[model samples]
Target: MTRPKISQMEAYMIETLRASGVTNEAIIQAAKEKDVSTWKQINDQYDFEQLLVLAEQDFSTFEEIINDGYAVKFVTVGGLERLLKLKFQKVEGKDFQKLKTGVQGLDLSGSSLDELKQMLSINWKITKNNEYVSVLLKEKKDFA
Candidate 1:
């Protein structure tokens, strides 16, 4: 059987994954699992954009990626900043200052979600196990 030809975008994605330290075999496996027949198909079938973002990250370990339910990793200072913005809206003010003070001069690039939660004053929990890490918000009660 002849292998299907990959498009330029597919090639780019593969190269990006490879450059990010993904083994060629792993890339091929991922492509096969997605049944990626063309570049356009890849976008339709997978979170191609997210994958691109992950490629730019510098995750401390592959286990982190595997443990992250979204298969996403944030391993760069910029990536950490983006995550904070997404989760907290504004990365400024007292809460931000508290966070900064908590982790002052510390390297967060390779920190786990649980570790991050511990460093902040957020009322969220990191439900991390051998399988994955999930962030859950605490329920708020209405006071009379």
Candidate 2:
């Protein structure tokens, strides 16, 4: 990853860890080790609570997007992850029906299909009815 991307991910991780009541010392340690692998380790170890919080926030944002009839075409891994989380939650069939109701559709782009699949822990057999989210495995040049 590039320096700025690493920095952004670091900042995001720090904010997430802080929100989840992680200790300042741990945060400092994470900050001291600034690299993609280290960040992934920190995220894997500490991102559960924050991911739930972010998923809720993303759901609210999606609600607004649907309300205002916004045609969303998100071109970021974060966006794709948000959608995937919602989709996974919905598939789990636990108090997530409200998300699919009155929804048109959205386009979600990520770095690679394989990369995103690797991030998923569960086997999600998403069907056509659950096609509210359209996936776009975008090349790096498209982002540039």
lDDT of 2 by residue, 1-144 (tens): 111111223234544554555555553333334222433544576443433343244544423322221222222444334433433322222322323221124322343333334332222222223434433344456455
Task: Compute each candidate's TM-score over C-alphas.
Answer: 0.24, 0.22
Worst 10 residues of 2 by lDDT: 1-10
Predicted candidate 1 versus true structure: per-residue lDDT over 68-98, tens digit per residue = 3122221233333444444333353422332
Global lDDT of each candidate: 0.37, 0.35
lDDT for model 2: 0.35
Highest-scoring model, TM-score: 1
What's the CA error at residue 50 for candidate 1, in Å? 6.5
Residue runs of model 2 more than 4 Å from their true location after superposition: 1-15, 18-28, 31-106, 112-114, 126-144
Query: RMSD of candidate 1 to the true fold?
Result: 16.1
Model 1 steric clash pairs? none
